[model samples]
Target chain A: MKYLRLVLRSFLRSKRRTVLTILSITVSVALIAILQSILATLNAFANNPDASNRIVVRHKVSITNLLPTRYADWLRQQPEVESVMGLQWFQGVYIDRSNFFPNFASEAEFVNTVFKEEIVEYSDAQFREFLRDRNGALVGKNLADKYGWKLGDVVSLKSELFPITVRLTIRCIFRSKRPADELALHFNYKLLEEGVSYMKGRVGTFFVRVHRADDVPKLIERIDRHFHDAVEPTYSETENAFQLEFLKMMGNYSAIIQMITGAVLVAILIVTANTMAMAIRERTTEISVLRAIGFRTSQILAMLMGEGILLSVLGGAGGLAIAWLLAGAVRGYVGTFLPYLQNFHIDAGTMSLCFHATLAVGTLSTFIPAYRAARRPIVDGLRSL
Target chain B: MSGEPIIRLRGLAKSYYRESLEIPVLQGIDLEIPAGGYYALMGPSGSGKTTLLNLIAGIDRPTGGELEVCGHTLNGLDDDELAAWRSTYVGFIFQNYNLVPVLTAFENVELPLLLTPMSRRARREKVEEALAHVGLTEWMEHYPRQLSGGQEQRVAVARAIVGDPELLVADEPTGALDHKNAEEIMALMEGLNRDLGKTIVMVTHDPKAAHHARHQIHLEKGVLDRTIEVNR
Candidate 1:
């Protein structure tokens, strides 16, 4: 405690050098934090709490390929299947591509049953109104508020993949337990089927609500086996596994994020090590004088290590603050491509990981240099100008 | 003003090497100084006067010889033990008044005491007394750069004695000061020796500074030339 002022003054001896070193560490740590947050957000999609008891069945070839609508009936025949819905992805733009949100064509009757846990604020009358009209749709509350669309408002969407326009009356606005779940719009599948020739009597996937979470894997295998000999075979898995499969198509980005984070931290280690080495080099005489004054080598090493840690922690905290502030902007940047990234924020787990990573960087960077400096013979150090 | 010998060196030797080629600095040195004795080591450049003082201060190890200071043999003690011994018994002053530039006079004086188990209040009291002893009581809060060369040296002296070590070793104590300040520093060292009973060993090239000591030892070509008892 008595030597704290000396440590701080020695740290700031070369202000420009210290500031630049801190800036380098800050940039690296911020990059690491932001990259880790992205991985966390991506992982969240597969771990959504609402997806526990659900499974998805798609065409064996690819999700882009359509499955026959009759597969929904076949899946419903399974003893463990409680409710089944045909869901089709409708890649559409309303007004502009920048205002994008998820739009899905779902079996209207089974949509409510399959997503019971997700819907937090929707009325039975509104759901009935949506069922009464073939051209009715339900928008999540977040999407409704984003576009300023109230109940009874007509929403017109131009399909990008198909040569059709979907216009429907908003019969219900639903809130969900998860913010990501509330950014979707679901409409009657038959309305889309009737309008587009390629989408008729077909769905891109089937969301099967299972009676027991433990039965999901067995039912998935049964449904796939039942359609194995059919004209269009089926691929089935739990909803989370299916989401993870889609993530796999992006080719192991989690590993890439890990690599990038590692590289950034290594760079930080090098920069900090170089800075401390130079600082210790400059203070060789002072260090020798301290030794001459009877300070132990361990004490000197502790002081230098303390200074390094202080610098790294300061930089890391600054980086974390910057990363936290930039999360919203990042969501805006990549949210359209990965719509499930809504409500993106740095979680406690990621922050904890970053905190430890910063400490490790600080320690590893200063260890060798500080050790060598502290162990140098006092006479030699005193000889250095 | 002397008692039993505080420093005893027998055939001490020190050598430097340049890529395996040995260059001797001090050789065949034998000396002893009683407790509370004020002595000066005088020599020209490369005579190893500073080297002998460093050996006596336990900052440097002798290449081959017996050295005993304050009743502890300087042989076979590890670096850490040597450091602790120095902390308890030896104080140092450098030619440049090597006070940490960032520290105030009081803090610099308080540094050596930090190695001891002294409380903060106790350290403060000791530091104040040491600075006052050197007439630097008013400059305790000033940094080295804020003081004159002589004042800076005085602060260094105060820092040396703050731990109340039994032996004070100085290398060119007034080498960087003007004549007036050098005279003041010499007088301060004299007071420390006579009033505080500190045994002093100083190295200097200046005869005037050497005159303040009770005894003088000269070294030439790493060999002792003579020991003179000054009649001051």
Candidate 2:
């Protein structure tokens, strides 16, 4: 603390260079924070604790392959199964191709029961009204709020996968634990079946809710075994695993993000190291004078290291602030295309990582140069003047 | 000047090594300066006068022989120990003033005191007193760049005396100053020696500056040539 003023004065000696170094670190840290937050959001979906008791049943070939809707009946008959629902990705565009969201055709009777953790809240009367009306649709609160949709508003969607346009009336607006889940719209599967002839008894997936969390593994094994000899073999996994499968389709995104973050860190380290090296080199004479005046080599090293760390921490803080302010806009933009990132925000873990990363950069970058400056022969330094 | 000498050197030697070759700067020179004595080392360029001063100040160690300054055997102490000893017993003033450009005059003067266990208020009072002694009290807040060459050297003098070290070693303290500034600096050193009884050793090429000292030691080819008791 006694040397803080000296360090601060030396740091501000070159205002332009210091500010530039800080800005470089700030921009790099912000990029790392945003990228890491994206990875965190995806990981959260694949590790959700709420998905423990639920299982998903899909065709053995691929998720794109449809299964017989009668699979839900067999799933429901199992002693471990509490409820089941058939869900299909509609791949529909509302108004035009620009407005995109996950719209699904689902069996309304067991949706709230099978996905109780996701469908956190909804009106019972509104759900009954949705069941009574053939063209009724259930919109998530975020989706409804985004489009300024209300009860009785008619929404028309043209399907890209099938030759049909289904006009739906908004009946129930439900809330979910995750903002990503709340950016979807669901309607009765019967509507799609009535619109297209071949889609009558097929669904993309069947969601099964087990009576207990421990029953999920056994039930998944039994269901896959029961359909092994049938015309369409089944693959069953817990809901968390199903979400991870979707993420897996993106191909090792975690490694890619980590690589990019690493590259950015290395680049910033080089930049910061170069700046500190130059600063120390410029003060060689001053350093020697201090040494000659009875200041210890360790004291000189401490003051220089303090300056470097202070610069990096300042940049790290600025970057975190930038990431925080832009989080909402990032969520809104990315939610349009990637459903998993709709709730994307910089969590405490990511902030801590960035802060620690900057400290490491500061220490590693300044160590060699500061040590060299401190250990240089005092006579050589004095002679340089 | 009674009692034992403040500085004792017995055949002190220093050399520079360039890879496989050796270049000797000081060789088998012995000298001593009594306590409270104002002495000047006068020689031509590269005569090893500054090297001798540096050795006496404990900033550099001799490659051979014994060196004792301020009653401490400098030859036996390591680099860190030498630094600590210098802080307690020796102060330095360089040819270029060597004030840290980033620090104000006050900060530069306070640099030596920061290494001590002195309180902030005590250090401040000492620094102010030193600067006032140098007639630079009003320029305390100004940076080195803001001060004149003479004023900067005065600040350097303040810094050298602020810690109240027993010995002051100056290597051409007026080498960068004009005639008027050099005279002012010489007068200040003379006053420090006569009034406060500081043991002063200065290396200089200026005859007028050397005349300010009570004794003059001349060096040639890295060895002491003669000693003269000044009539001043």
TM-score of each: 0.96, 0.98
Model 2: per-residue Cα lDDT over A1-385, one tens digit each: 7889999999999999999999999999999999999999999989998889989999999988889998888888999889999998898899887788899899988888887988899999999998888899988999999899999999999999889999999999999988988988889999999998888999899988888999887888899999999999999999899999889999999999999999999999999999999999988999998999899999999999999999999999999999998888898887778888898999999999999999999999999999999999998888886
Clashing pairs in 1: none
Off by over 4 Å in 1: none
* Model 2: DockQ vs. true structure: 0.82
| Cα misplacement distance, residue A191 of candidate 1 (Å) | 0.8
lDDT of 2 by residue, B82-116 (tens): 88998889889889998999999999999999999
Docking class of 2: high
The superposed Cα distance between candidate 2 and the true structure at residue A60, in angstroms, equals: 0.6
